[model samples]
Target: MSINELTKKLKNEAYSSLYLLYGKEKYILEYSQKLIVQAVLDEGSADFNLSSYDMEEQPIEAAIEDAETLPFMGDHRVVIIQNPYFLTGAKVKQKVEHDLKKLEQYLQNPSEQAIVIFIAPYEKLDERKKIVKALKKQGEVIQAEKMNVQLQKEWINHASKEANVKMTDEAVERLIELQGENLGLLIGEVNKMALYVGEGGVIEPSIVDELISRSLESNVFTMVEHVANRRIDAALRICYDLLKQNEESIKLMALLARQFRIILQVKQLKAQGFTEKKMASILSLHPYAVKIASRQSRAFSEEELKDLLIRAADADFEMKTGQRDKQLSLELFMTGIHKAKQTN
Candidate 1:
């Protein structure tokens, strides 16, 4: 089932007998698990009804047996089976023997009075297995994956609505620019901003600029933009700010190199008639990031980008070899690039 379907079901107190929550997105996976528990049992009854087992150390039959049993004092029993590695194609040495037959039998006839949840934190499951096919047929499978740009914007809007505040489109865009696509951090920042704005208040771009902390990578991206625009003073100011925050010069240089590399790649790919989505897939980057890089790539020719990369490598070598002061080497690299742009 989709997350929205699960949310609607939980809203109406409609509980499912079997749930297979598997994903790489830890925040969504854990949050969904909590929501299920909250919907299945009250605070007082949770102590008696909720049971968790680790399949890594314990047998699957133990969890299946618990699921077969009735609740102690509640209407339903909730059994959480964690780290079911056998369901995947991984070759992990078993610490304990699991009765797959028992699990298969339980899936064929799950207890009506129990809610069994399988939490498999994996990218892909072994679909070839009969047990996996049976579970898919019998349970509600929720795949938690990373959200794309549009989905992320929708999530921000939903979060704002939940907080009883309104977020403008510009504000949402700025939040993504500052926070990147980490959903957990984005939600936390959204809640904090909501509290500041209070109920019935609108969140604007100015508020986002004032309240949200800029990540190092975001700062580096901004610095590169300043360089591209020939605003050397603004770029130097950002470098100083990061230095004041005790950011190592070597780390900053590495990020700078990475940013330049991305811009060059985006430029080359765009020249080849590649779409933004296709470029993101090839580069293993978010589409939004690719979009930004594509725009930035216009400010410099391919030759300039190649030169900057070489300079960055030379600066790195000098710093690591103790041939120059690390901070001085970074400053020189930036200023030298600025001068080269002006001369050209």
Candidate 2:
């Protein structure tokens, strides 16, 4: 089920007896867990009704037993079964033997008085297993996967509303540009920005520009973008700021090379008729990154990208081998790219 559907059901207090939450997105998985906990137990009953067991250290039967147990002074109990590796194809060293038969039997007729949630933080589950099959038939399976750019924007809006602030579209785009697609960082930044703006305030692009913290990698991306646009002075200013912040020149060179490499790959893939979505999937990058790289790739020829990469590599070697001052080498590289852009 989608997270929105789950939210709607939970909002109506329609609780499921069995829920299998599995995915690689920890933020969504964690958020979904919190929602379930809030929906299942009140603050007063949570301590007595909520039970968690790690399958790595405890057997599945223990969790099942808890699920079957009656709630303490409440109408429902929440039994969280964590790290049920047996549900997946992964080969984890067994510290305790799980009674799959007991689990299978419990799945057939789960307790109506309790909610059993399997928190499987895995990319995929072993669907071939009988227990997995039984669980699929018996429970609601919610896959907490990564959100696309649109979904991410929606999340930002929702979070901003919850904080009693409004985020402009430009502000949302800027936040993603600066912070990438890390939901955790985005939400934290959103909350902080909301507090600064106060209730009923609107967060604009300028507010994001002033308040958001740019990572080293993000700064490098901006620097390269400036280089692509032939804004050498702006690019150098960012580089100097990093130097002031005690960022090593060698590390900066490495990040520059990585960004250029991505641009080169995106350019080649685009030439091969691959869409941005396809490139994102192939490159294992966020779609927004692919979008930025695609736009940045347009400023340089494939030959120019290759030349920039070679120069970055040579500068890296020189700095690491002590053949040149690290900061000077990085500056020369930046200037060199700028000069190349000018001559073109």
Candidate 3:
């Protein structure tokens, strides 16, 4: 099931014994988790009923043991096992793998008294694994995809509403420009803006610039989005305007280079178990950039991306050295993208 479906089920009291939630997008899945927790366990009783486990650092069997033993004075229990990919590796103790099938049997008919949730983002679920089959039959699986510029706008609107803050479209655009387009950074920036602006939700460009000095989902980031998405014509226009407005060519290239570098890093980071939010911070790129970069990275073959990075490095070298005619090279570089011929 999708996050929407899962949310609907939990909201409607359609409880399941097990839930498998994993994806590039986490906000919606988090919402689903909360809804499920709320539905199955009372707010006042949450402390006793909810138990979480970090299987990457520990054993899944230990968590299962905790689940088997019910909470005191609670009608139902929730056990969340996170990052169990280690279970299939040699690093995992043999004792757990030998009894993996037992976990499957439990999922096949999980106790009515408990709700089990597994979170293993950025890792594949090997259906050949014993528990995977039972989960398919017994629970809901939710895949969360990260947001892009368009969706970023929707998120901004939603976040402002949540914070009881108001934002102008220009302020929203400006905020995104500074941050890049990652939902986490955008949300964080918006929260800051909301606080500074007295929760009036009144966001102006000047106030936005002052309050949330860091945002990845803003207009300049959108400008880059137009280029990476291969809306080259529109991107060219934006580029020309930025130049006209005295935006530094070196700075622009730095921005472009940072964008592509993040794309490459996001691809690798996502593969290495880095969460979307963590990838942005570690890459020192905007979360919004990481969000789209991860998706766009799939559009290029690993070789293509590597080649593009080489091109960016060359462009950066020439442009910075002033060894080449600036406008001509930058324009040629922009046009060169069409040669790649990939439409995002």
TM-score against truth, every candidate: 0.94, 0.90, 0.58
Better of 1 and 2 by TM-score: 1
- Give the runs in model 3 whose Cα sits over 4 Å from its true position: 1-5, 26-35, 86-98, 128-130, 165-170, 197-200, 204-206, 215-344
Which 10-residue window of candidate 2 scores lowest in summed lDDT?
Answer: 143-152
Q: Best lDDT goes to which candidate? A: 1
Assess each prediction's global lDDT (C-alpha) against the native: 0.92, 0.91, 0.72
Residue 236 alpha-carbon offset, candidate 2, angstroms: 2.8
- Write the residue-wise lDDT of candidate 2 on 93-190 in tens digits: 89999999999999999999999999999989999999999998998888877678887898899899889999999999999989877887898899
lDDT of 3 by residue, 107-159 (tens): 76677778888876643566776667677668877755666555778778878
Look at candidate 3 and tell me the lDDT of residue 161.
84
Best by TM-score: 1
RMSD of each: 1.7, 2.3, 11.3
Q: On lDDT, who's better, 1 or 3?
A: 1
Q: What is the full ranking by lDDT, best candidate first?
A: 1, 2, 3
